[model samples]
Target: MIREGVMNQAQKLLAGLKIPALQAPMFLISGPEMVINACKSGIVGSFPTPNARTPEILDQWMAEITEQLSSAQNPAPWAVNLIVHPSYPRLEADLQVILKYKPPIVITALGSPKNVVEAIHSYGGVVLADVVNTTYAKKAASAGVDGLVLISAGAGGHTGYLSPFVFVNEVRQWWDGAIVLGGGISTGKNVFAARAMGADAAYLGTRFIPTKEALCVDEYKQMIVEASSDDIVTSDAITGVKANWLRQSLLNAGLDPDNMTAKGKIDFASNGADNKRWKDIWAAGQGVSASESVSDVSSIVNLLAREYVSAASELTQTLKPGNRE
Candidate 1:
């Protein structure tokens, strides 16, 4: 049976869905087209506000996604990811737009989202915060966020080093609100594992990076396909935030992954959409090794759905109650 609080935000939000998964709001990569496909395929789609480079463009994206997804057949709820930190100069303005439209879900990153909780709550939107540890998860719970996304090791971009198993268990001890597990989730079996581990759903990023709908360069997508876990390097070098990047991308930037001088600062003002910051320094996860080729969102979701059902059936025989070895 599904847990009690697990159905609070996630269930109401995703009332009727094929798989309980949310395509992570990747910076620059997740745009209108990608978000549209994810929703069209009966999954939550999202994108970061700063990916538009300007608030005006963000407004356009919001309008486009809202119109398209709302009219789509049996569309799933969509979300917007906001960097709720002081460093982002346009946080207030971008948040204004979000509060205006009020997508079903709002995901906050970088810092506490307590300040916006009241406003977001006013519009009946659920706020989900990204947390790496119990500290941030408790902070988000105190802030009245509807859910928490545990970003653990093997996740792409600004990932945590903790194991998802340990972090999820720790968070559950204090809070039982909606929990979304991220990192190392590349397939449907992984999503099932997340739910079994007490998560309401799973959040995936790198798996979507190589998809056809993503707004990424062909080279970056191909690099994700060609690389593996060892090809992923974690360091606070790219954006002054500890994140995973493809080692080959570092080589293309004329830097050695093992030893190099990295001068990373929080430059929220700069645009990395098509420039060296992101274009040359690709952000990926250890799960990139699972990405075999470039495909569409629907195809990937279809494969995940099939895999999830198969895994669930297989677990009935081996992971049943009192069957532990």
Candidate 2:
């Protein structure tokens, strides 16, 4: 049976959405400004704990997010992503900050959520596990998470290999809780398609990387604007896990996209050596083509809302008796 508190918190997170989507927790790209703007624009905003660089900074970020969202008009809920892997040196320190602030939703990645679920649930907060495949999905479900973020193929950063179609359908067979489909989803029509495929919400990361509020540099944003699906190359060289990267950024960093052979070790420590490397080698998914310009979070959301409505209307027409040819 689904835990009542977990289920309720999940529903509460979804209740305020203008669109069934989440501004995915990007590593260095997301911050207080992005989260605040995204919440104000009517979708869940989130950032990884590692983005703060320290627990004190995380405390300040959560405080600012809560203070701002509380004053905003009908702001959607905000989420915090945590690297629950034991090897992450700051996991305990980060979790303490999380407990003190109590973000409405906590997304756990890189490890089991079991270590932090009870503490988060104690404050009526919900936990969503980021799983790349059905095996991880089932394990997370058994760990008592409120939802699963299926990081399928074509996603940015550390991505999954399974197609969303295959992943979502396979997971739905056993789990009835929330399912947030991620991977190459950068448009409202993509969001609508996710819902049509039985996902409760769409998870978007690369789409938001070029926004004004993103912490990334101007050149990074510019690359995302100029990029297409073919520009994204997947390799485990940068982060020791399979993730998509912009081809040009790899070249700029002096690494050949086609010939990268270094399988870097995975380390989530706040002070890890790879931090500087990530800054130079940018990550983006196949959906980078959708970002035609550098815009504000509000404008992006507004455009997405319009596209979502149009897509829904078109679908309605297509399903009408005379139009179904």
Q: Which of the numbered candidates is closest to the native, going by highest TM-score?
A: 2
Q: How far in Å is the alpha carbon of 202 misplaced in model 1?
A: 0.6
User: What is the per-residue lDDT of model 2 for residues 254-300, given as tens digits with 9 covering 90 to 100?
Assistant: 88899989898887664557678789899999899999999999999
TM-score of 1: 0.94
lDDT of 1 by residue, 1-325 (tens): 2355445764467546779899999986999998889989888999998888788999998999989987889898889999987777888999999987789899999999999989998988999999888888888889999889999999998898899999998887877678889998999999999989988889999999988888888999999999989999998877888889999999999889997457578666555533458767889988997789999898999998999999999988787577766
Candidate 2, lDDT over the whole model: 0.90
Weakest ten-residue segment in model 2 by summed lDDT: 1-10
Q: Which candidate leads the pack in lDDT? A: 2
The C-alpha RMSD in Å for every predicted model, in order, reads: 2.6, 2.5
lDDT of 1: 0.87
Say what the RMSD of model 2 is.
Answer: 2.5
lDDT, candidate 2, at 8: 46
**Candidate 1, superposed: residue stretches over 4 Å from native:** 1-6, 260-263, 271-275, 319-325
